[model samples]
Target: MIVVLLAFTLASFWALIAWKGMQERALAFAKAGSETQGLTHSLAQHASKSFNAVALALFGAGQYILHSDKSARASAEINDLLAQYAKNIPQVREIGVLAENGDWMFSSFETVPAVNNGDRDYFRYHRDHPEDETPRISEPLTSRVTGRPTLLMTQRLSNPDGSFGGVIFAAIDLAYFRSFYAEFEADLNRTVTLMKTNGKVLVHRRDDQVGKDMTGTALFSGRLKDAGTGLYSIVSPFDGRTKQFAYERLSDFPIVISVAVAEDTILDGWRGDRRFDLLLGAAISTILIGLAVVLALQTRKRSVMARMLRERERGYRLLAENVEDVVTRIDMDGRRLYVSPSIEKLLGWSADEIIRESAYSNIHPAHRELIKGLIGQLGAQNRTATCEYMTRRRDGNYVWVEAQLNFVQDPDEPTAEIVGAIRDISKRKAAEEQLVAANEQLKALSETDPLTGLANRRRFDRMFDAEFKRCQRSGSQLSVLFIDIDKFKSFNDTYGHSAGDDCIRQVAGALASCLKRPADLVARYGGEEFAVLLPETAAINAEVVAEAARNAVHDLAIQHHGSPDGSVTISVGVAGGKCDARNSTSSMLAAADGALYLAKEQGRNRVCVAAENPSLTLVRPAG
Candidate 1:
């Protein structure tokens, strides 16, 4: 019977250890997956924004080629414009326009090459499909001039009659992406990849794996097709190691960004813990079996057994005193019976000093009730309870802590005690707070214009739509002010782009200062243009605000050699009315635009108001 009981006890202990090991393994993987997913999301956003900027440059060049005179197509002005586009976008290696027959007409490069791209896949596709006006991203290929690996972003240029004219393309160096991805590879077992949805790799941590086809893999054909983002584990075909992967698809482009860490790398800590637990369990099991045998054989040697038990008790007490976490023994009434010496290191209190005080005395006033409730649960259920709360240290500073309480009852006595462990969790709490702050900062950056420091066009449109609906429901008046810097293009041509940027920033700051009300929103609408949304304001009140903004910009006195006023100035247009089924945000925008055109027409540095009718009303001019 003794042998059977000992065997059953050992089996139960090992079973519990196995269960805990499984839980720890799962938790380790979960943590790695979550971190990888977040990294993939950030990388995807960066790629999308880079591609979008390049596409915008291509579109702008296409528009210029289509509208400009044929004689000026290959002139120095066009070359300068292309070079400027390339200079502004860091991801773009070159910008050029090709003739109808694929001859290089002009380029941003310092020395124009005589390369003909008529046979290139992107050029052929645009020439073959005249109706497809969307931008095309080509597969990776070597550039004809620079001989570098490049991805071409092309938009088709058309003649006046809608026939294929040529392709205006931007060459993006693959090394740019490879360099960006290399920064994230902090671990030897971690990898980052940027690839097309069709499975052709553009850039990989392993340079030799570039251009490998992955369409046969489950990631491209199954998981990616079903969702835009996901996390999974698979054996990498390039390197036969099992990896946990997190991937995100770019919203505006056919690109996938993936972050992977080796499965062994993620589970290394778990495996170590499992080994330690197994050894500890085996040691305890062997001791138990030996004690049972001794009891069966040497029943008369009971005093020696008692002495061994007392020594074991002393060992346990020594361990409790040395651990970093504070250990305490308390009565059911929350009186501290014993306190560990580690309390002095954790909370600046000696063990003897803490034992004299009630357990709830050190807890913050707001958190005292929480600690009391957790203790109550342990007493009633005779189980463990855990809670987090703020406690006052001896220095009068509050620190965050996590406390776990376990109910202990002696079978031979009628009294019960509570064993508690208190660990300082201030660093973890601080990290959680910093994460929330970073999220808020990211949100703000997404909605703000980088150059002018005002709300971006995307944010303006969202707020405008919401304000329109709200005012429509409340029957309040809604107003809009469309403002433009007078002769901005001439200013750019006279003082250069850098000076022009400074002029815009100053004007934006002045406009922001004039609006005193909290509900007013001034946003950078586009290049050299600004818009203001005024809720619960009539057209007359809007004109007043518009005039104030105009004067504020004029007060900056930024010298513009190309302007008639000899200083920077703005033209303002005001439109306002009750929003209903008949009145829409688009109509209000159109009215404001027309009024702004009239203001520019009747001379710059003045304010104009648009009536409900098509006629424009002139307001007072700025000084």
Candidate 2:
């Protein structure tokens, strides 16, 4: 029995501990994952900004080199200055000046012929797009002469008379960019690569990829081009690990900068955390096992005489201390004979002070007589009693308790006594009450429009169904006004979706405010449409309300850009009363829809009531 008890205790205790530990670990992992993604996004933004800054500085230096040489004597001086500038700007490799007919007049490298670069694509691209004021950064195109990976930067030049005569073209070294990017990143394994929009690898941190064709590869295939700029995770061909990669299109340039970090690099911290948790678990298990062994050995030597008595006392003490519920024993006279240690925990009173006192005195005065009657019922039938009772704490505050009592004979004495367990149910009761309130609030929110704070489509549907049946049973009136905004689609197309949402919110607010009674329901029927259920209103009164809605919307006079009419308006349609003997719900909706079409067909911005207009019968007339 002792071994069985020990096994049970160990299994239950460790199960609880392990469950909580695993929960904490799962939460830690989720938090770490969110932080890692955030960090990667921040790094991507920084890379794009760096690319823009470098491109701008290189273009400025090249422009200064091209414009300084206006005469032959100054040509030699300008060539020397251009060479110094190219060396100073680490990202710039070669600078050259080209005429309109694609003739390169000046070259940064003296050995290269000036005529060699005349007919390149850079000069032709500038000539095609003459109106673009910004500097043109060409897509990564391989140079025919150098046969090295390069990007071209061309800025148009004006002669003294402001005529477009020539352009300054620069050949930027892609390797220099890779080195500059390497200095900015701390992770050695992280790869940074530059590529053209056309899927050619211009420069990779690895030297072998300088002139490689990367078209079929997933990274350059279309993912980066389609996304334009953002982060992506892809399987790396080089190492097979999932790489968290991000890319950005350089401003005024067709090239994209990509940064890829390995998955293991981000998970490094989580791995350390798991190791620390395992060490802590091992230490705790060792301590618990040692304590269990000592307890078992002590139990064997006591021989069950004194041990039984001590255990009984310990059991009672533990029940009082560990269990949050109150335990008490009472005499036939209803006097408290004993109370557990938790009496102090629950009521702020020591056991000594409460022993021998009338237990009913602790209960609230309003509940004392009711509890006495319940106890009488328990004794008459030899059955237990369970009830909820409010008791006064020593602090004079009230708490809710659920109590169960039954008669028992005291082992110390043969006299009968009532032993009872009372649990503090205040927190549970409060939670139940809060849960009920929250459910009700959630039900309300589900039926309400979050923007206009009006009844949403769900509420409108329910109200319409109920009101339609009520009108049918009573043979009374039920009017539904379907109001649509005039030229709402054109307004959204012209201004913006945000302004369209604002317009809907404003109109719904106006419709709700104009409602005079609680029985009148105004709802956002669908996108730009609104509905009002006016029970007991005839077609004439429904027309008045529809006209009021139309005028109310017109008075708003909300400015819209796309409409040739240039002002906001609402076209309203009203159909009311149980005219047909059958009065089907479908027929009522058709009537309202027919009226709305007439309102729109009559050049919009007007109210039309189908039930009142005898000339225009319902297209699908009431059955």
Q: What is the overall TM-score of model 2 with all chains considered together?
A: 0.41
lDDT of each candidate versus the true structure? 0.88, 0.72
Per-candidate clashes come to 0, 1
lDDT score of residue 519 within candidate 2: 92
The best candidate in terms of lDDT: 1
> Estimated TM-score per prediction?
0.55, 0.41
Q: For residue 527, give model 2's deviation from the true position in Å.
A: 1.3
What is the per-residue lDDT of model 2 for residues 1-623, given as tens digits with 9 covering 90 to 100? Answer: 65576567667656755675677556654553454345445544654554554454445444454446568667776566556556545666776666667676556677546465545676766666666535666766777657776777677765556556677766777666677667645662677777666766766766676656667776567776577666667787545788677676655556666767776675676567667766766677677678777867876665675677677668677766667787888877788977887889888888888874588988988999998887766653576888998898888999999999997755676667788999899999889889999999999999998878889989988988888877777888888888889889899998899999999988987687557667999998888988888988887888877876775675566897654457888888888877357666666767787788788888888888887676764563454
